[model samples]
Target: MTTNNNTLLCWHSKRAGVEVLVEAIKCLKNRRVLINRAIVLVQTDTDSSLYLNHEFGDIGLRFITASLENPANHNEIYQRLETSVLPELKDVANLHINVSPGTPAMHAVWLILHARGHFPSGTKLWSSQFNPDTKRTSISSVDFNVNTYLAEISAISNSEGSYALYGVDPKSAARREALATLKEFAQVPKAPLLVLGERGTGKTRLIESVVGIVKQKKVVTLACGGLDSQVVDSMLFGHVKGAFTGAETQRSGLLREAEGKVLFLDEIQDLPTSVQRKLVRVLQDNHHYYRSVGSDKEETSDFELVCASNKTIKELATTLDADFFDRISMLTITIPPLRICREDLLDDWQKIWGEVNVNPSLPKHAPTSRQLNKLLESSSLAGNLRDLKKLAFITCAYMNSYSPTEALSKAICSLQAFDDIEENEGTKFSFGDLSNTTKDELDKLFKYELARAAKRQFGTWSNAGKNLQVDQKTLQKYMKNDS
Candidate 1:
């Protein structure tokens, strides 16, 4: 078949099958191709077996194999195609298309195509759409337009899917508003973002979701907890070959790799004073210097910075270098804890449990509204979403053997045991049985618990203030009045 070099027929693996086929058709339409040859690239001989043995096996197309199981051969295959086969193609006008689904192989094909300079500048790429039904299946193409494809991409990018590893229910209107605000900031133009939340409220998942949106962008995630100044410096800035005792070969630092993408530093509060100073410089100037063994070269890299911490920047501002604190504080969003968003448990539970295989035949013992309310009311989720999800899964298993009421009663009794620990651990103030306390006393107790909860959640006055739905100064007054 005659085809233009402008239209490349790139077929990704048929794992996501018809969804990818539909996407490929959409891309073909956008490229304005009248007729094109399809090149189906299979990751394995087994994968190729499926298509070769399929009913529609007579489609006029070439098949290429690019499996990663054997690295040496894959490299040879890549070179041969890049240097030989691709150059020898009869129709350079045939648009290079990638119809791979699911596997990293699809992305690899796209990168290879880009490296070969086959497509014109600003060529939009479409990813294979996910099929929730059928296990390990294939698909056929559907008619799609460019605008429709773009809309699908946008929707997929924003919506929650199986990729959301961990999540919590947003119980209150205020908490939901806070989540919306965080999502908004994630979509904002490349700028430093600070995520302020409690330890277990799924701050990491929020960041991962943002990373998913900017899939093309490089992501460098750093966990700053328990690292001292020198370790922090070595990891972030990198060291020269022989720069330190363990240094062997010259390594590219995360900052360099994160260029034009995201550098997520988790537990930002743990960053040492000296390294914080260097981070500030990088954020402001978008460049840094690295000294290697027997060589000194200044490297320049630009990246969007996203920071997360259980502590508030304000509390750590005095302890951290002032310049670093000021630079990152410009953009901050607080993530609310599970206790505040108790109402969201059922929905979150359904989304989570639906994806994983959890003994489908076990029994239909889903939590009732009354049961959910009782679960929320009786227990304090000290670990927030992380704790809640774990508890839910446990409750699911626990309920299979026992009745819902019996399972729930056992769970509540176990949780109440922790109250004894809380009492003996310290005189930590709690909201405590507001049912019996007077309104005035309850108000006083609520303020006390809120402050304490904030302190536990964020580890700093300023961040806890943000979670409390108040400004820093107002939080200070509340703290003082309680004292």
Candidate 2:
């Protein structure tokens, strides 16, 4: 619906076409005067001019096109801004964006960017909603001032709100402050950042957040601790053909892809010592030049580095040189463990539990708060959010196939099994005293757990086998032994 004179930007809704949008605008026009000009954003596949604008004869709502199958994609917002909105708004004196006629995500993008003060100086935001009782729709131009923008941003990004900012709510003051810092960091041209946290405490998740919320040339990641030194080096720095016995292809590395953007190196403590030195050199000289393992020619990749580790800067300094650590430890952010964040734990637990219980993909079972508390209290999650998710998965599996009590028992049993295996120094398990099942059942259970662990650790049997010092063929055979 068009409200202001200069420009009105909106996405074409498959459900409610421009005719309905025009009807809504007409109803709003009954109450007050309307704008004369507009610029409608449309997908490449859609001919937004098919209808509706014809009826608004005096008001020419010009159509601008961008290719977007999913309006919800954050990338679409950038595409829209670049290809449509910014180009159209160059000389426009005022603007009003009607977000009523698009996808929920489209509406959110409009509201969020405007709330973040991204639009032209006098741009106003409004929504047109049809009223069944009144059989009419009217323009509700939000005050769209600094006061409402700030207030609405907090409310909209809060847990209870319909739209979460990048799918996360900054509930506490600390988290809110961290989010602010992250956003600011995202805007900077280049800066090294460090995130210290336990596994699954959202170090990688924040990297994703930066990609979504910030405009970057590109974003790439490397799991520094997960690969062999040579493999890691080849992945980070390109290798020429014949670099090593198996190096047959001259491949471009992630560093090149990350050039002029963000390069997230996860588990930075495990990064190779040689790589650490090279990285320090990059920071020291503000240049990223590397030679392929066998090639004499040097290559350059100018990128901002962000590193994450489950160790503190002090702990890292013991293993890494002071210079390397100092360059990396420039801007460090620590994620507090869930165990210590008692204030937010219950809320987090409730949301997680509710999601599991209500999911149509799983059998429905309402777990009591007290019962859930027992599971949480007994779990040695050690503040890892992934553990809570794993527990939820286990609970659902048991609730679907067995019982809640059985779920709780299995959850505790799995933890005990891990402890026993660790104490036994990774020796084959002994099912002698385990009274729950026959040999066949025990074998099946072991296979199931092994498969699950392998998937989590390496995502493929071959990688898992290599990590576990077992042959991939052996793992494949074990998987075939059945569930």
RMSD for all candidates, in order, please.
16.7, 17.1
RMSD in Å for candidate 2, one decimal? 17.1
Q: Model 2: per-residue lDDT, tens digit, 30-123? A: 6464657656667753567466436677777677776576677876675566445653553465676787786777777777666654455566
All models: lDDT?
0.58, 0.64
Worst 10 residues of 1 by lDDT: 142-151
Candidate 1: list runs displaced more than 4 Å: 1-171, 211-218, 287-295, 352-366, 377-380, 396-400, 428-483
As a TM-score, model 1 comes out at: 0.54
- Model 1 misses residue 349 by how many Å? 3.7
The number of the candidate with the highest TM-score is 1
Q: For residues 1-483, what per-residue lDDT tens digits would candidate 1 score against the true structure?
A: 224334334544454443455455554555464334455655666655554543433235556664545433545545544544443342234344443453454356445544433333333344434455743233233222333222322333324344323322244775778766775676666667888887887787667664435444555799999999877888788777888777878767777777777888998888998888777666775454443223476677777788888986667676667888888777788877666665565544444444332566644334545655655543456666555555556656667788756765565556546644763487444545667777776666566666555655554566567776787676555555453
